[model samples]
Target: MIDTHTHLYSEQFNEDLAEVVERAKSQGVEKFFLPAIDSETHEKMLQLEAAYPNEMFAMMGLHPCSVQPDTWEQELALVKSYLDKRSFCAIGEIGIDLYWDKTTLDIQVQAFEQQIDWAIERDIPIVIHTRESFPETFEVLKRKKHPKLRGILHCFSGTLEDAQTAIDLGFLLGIGGVVTFKNGKIDRFLNEIPLENIVLETDSPYLAPVPHRGKRNESAYTSLVLGKLVDIYQKDFREIEEITTQNALRVFGMK
Candidate 1:
């Protein structure tokens, strides 16, 4: 399995990074995709990837929550510089996040659009992080829709209509720990969305699945997310694993 989104570079794992990777690999998670938040953690992210070059891949982007009115442009410039310097798996976890502060919506939209253009120009995928701004996200996505634009909506927590719309817009819904939550309503309609339009992620150090909910999440818990999908889609574990791994590779253009 591929944990399509996780922050193994986070300080949360600084004490036992190797153990965490081994724990994840023990559960059959062969690859991990790391998303960049800002310049603050870029070196740590790169270092983690360096330690596990073949197993962990890094993405470059300015996360919405990091979009301060003062430093966003500088942060985006740094992102562009890195993209120009080398290649990354995607330009993400970038998108609007109104959950924290609604006042920065304009700049967040600017940053999101600019990063989307970067992904389109480079012909790479994007991993989006949308929180309390699906309508705003769709509006930008619809305007920038392109045959070359393809990616995942990381940690999807939206309505069924939003699911279909994202698929129509050339994106996959990234399923994660939330599906196991009693109130994570996506489970009610997830099976209705084809497995082809879905991929697996953990959003580690954030949304750990049931049994580990309210605790720090790790990549190993991706198996738990996959387990819930088995119940949701009523398919065999290996079958879901194969399909979702293929889905993730498809988004990353790996297979």
Candidate 2:
């Protein structure tokens, strides 16, 4: 399985990174896609990728929460510089996150649009992180809608209507630990959304699935997410992995 979204560079794993990867690999999670948080952590993310090579793919972008009014432009310049220097799996974990601070909405929108412009121009995929701003995120996608504009709604937490809307916009729902929550609700109607429009993630060190809900999440926990899908979709585990892995490959342009 491919953990399409994760933060293996997070300090939480600094003590035993190899052990974590080994644990994940033991669970059949062979590929991991890491998202850049900002200029501060981009180096760390790249270092982790270099350490693992193809096992760990890196993405470049300024996370919305990191978009400060004083330095967002400078950070975005760094993002552009990196994209020009090398390739990334996607320009992501980028989008508006109003849950933390609504005041930065204007700047967040600009950064989101600018980064999305980079993705469209480069013909690369984007991984969106919409929080408490689903409609607003969709608005940006609607405005920037193009045949070449495609990506994932990373850590998607919206209604069934929102799922269909994202799919309609040529995006996939990033299914993760949230679907395993008793109140995550997405599980109720997840089967309704075609598996083809879905991809698996853990959002590790963040939304760990049940049985480890409050604990620190690792890539291996992706199997738990997949297990939930198996129950929800009522399909075999191998079939679910095959389809979701294909979805991740398609979104990341991995072939």
Whole-model lDDT per candidate:
0.96, 0.94
Q: Residue 177 error for model 2, in Å? A: 0.5
Q: What's the C-alpha lDDT at position 127 in model 1?
A: 94
lDDT of 2 by residue, 38-99 (tens): 98789999999999997999999999999999999999999999999998889998999999
> Model 2 reaches what TM-score against the true structure?
0.99
What TM-score goes with each of the models? Answer: 0.99, 0.99
lDDT of 2: 0.94
Q: At residue 29, what lDDT does model 2 achieve?
A: 98
> Looking at model 2, which ten-residue stretch has the lowest summed lDDT?
148-157
RMSD of 2: 0.6
